[model samples]
Target chain A: MKARIKVTLKPGVLDPQGKAIQNALGALGFDGVNDVRQGKYIEVDVAGMSEEQARTEVERMCRDLLANTVIENYTYELAP
Target chain B: MKARIKVTLKPGVLDPQGKAIQNALGALGFDGVNDVRQGKYIEVDVAGMSEEQARTEVERMCRDLLANTVIENYTYELAP
Candidate 1:
């Protein structure tokens, strides 16, 4: 099975990377792009697991490996 | 309008950060995890646009701001 994890900075956090990207967009002539928040994408592959197991295991992966508990949040979905 | 963007390292690129996470997962006893590829997640909010236009505009935002095209690729879906 294949799973995708989305890890992001928590709300109320100041994302300097995101702010830098926002400035870059303005410089590139993209109009009305009000804001940008940057995070992380992690994809993992597993074998011999049911979809439910994949979700649970992958969630564990997020909490344990991919995301920082202090300042990040994560959500994941299985690739169908 | 709301959109979620996923940016990932292109295949064939060595992802050191991902490898580090994989090692961490192994240390944490996540069994049968074969690989990890790390990337980016970005969320943006928009107003006064149709879904079609949002897609286009957001794509521009991605190429212009959120993603580095040299070694990264990106995909996004609208939040309905």
Candidate 2:
């Protein structure tokens, strides 16, 4: 199974990197951008696991290592 | 309009960060992980624009600033 995960900063959390990107976009003459938020996209390939097992494993991975739960939120999907 | 963009390293490109994550998962006793790849997810809020215009603008942003193009590929979707 393959797991695709996205870890994003929770609402109201500061994101300096996103801010920098927004500013850089403005400087590059691209207008109309009001806000920007950046996050992480991770893909993991798991061997010898059923979909249910992969889901459980990936959820644990997120809680244990993939995310900083205090300020970030994570969501994932699994595919064969 | 809102644009959700994902920027990822092209296949065949080495990803040291992903390797480290895989190793860490193993160290944490999480097994069965065969491979891991990391990427970027970005959300942009555009003011006063139709979806078509937002798409065009965002495509340029991806090409010019959000993605390296040489090593990274980007895909995006727009939402109201």
Candidate 3:
């Protein structure tokens, strides 16, 4: 099975990389761009687990390592 | 408006960071993990554009600045 995790910054968190991208967009003439936030997406392959088990395991992985709980939120999908 | 972009490695590309994370997961005792691939997610806020326009603008941004078309693929979503 495979699990995909999307980790995003919580609302109101400062994102320096996002700000940098926004400025770069302005420099590149992409007018009207006002703000930007950057995040991470991770895909993992797991063996010997049912779909439900895989989701649970990946959720724990997100909490323990993939995401910073104090500033980020994560959601995941599991697939065979 | 807001646009969200996901940038992922093309199949067959080497991913050192993904490998590192996989090793870390194994060390942390998340068993049955076989592989890991990492990607990027970005969100941008734009003003003065219709949804269609925003998508087009972001598509161009991905092609020209945000993504390395040779090795990565990027998809984006636009929302009010």
Q: Highest TM-score: which candidate? A: 2
By summed lDDT, the worst window of 10 consecutive residues in model 2 chain A runs over A47-56
Which prediction has more favorable lDDT, 2 or 3? 2
- lDDT, candidate 1, A1-80, per-residue tens: 88888888999999998888777777887666677788887889777888988888998888776888899988887985
Q: What is the TM-score of each candidate against the true structure?
A: 0.86, 0.98, 0.94
**Residue B54's lDDT in candidate 3:** 86
Clashing pairs in 2: none
For model 1, the stretches where C-alpha displacement exceeds 4 angstroms are none
Which segments of model 3 are wrong by more than 4 Å?
none
Query: Interface RMSD in Å per candidate, to 1 decimal?
Result: 1.6, 0.6, 1.0
Top-scoring candidate (lDDT): 2
Model 1 chain A lDDT-worst window of ten: A25-34
DockQ value for model 2: 0.93
Q: Which residue pairs overlap in candidate 3's backbone?
A: none
For each candidate, the alpha-carbon lDDT, in order, equals 0.83, 0.96, 0.91
Lowest summed-lDDT stretch of 10 residues in model 2 chain B?
A: B47-56
lDDT of 3 at B69: 99
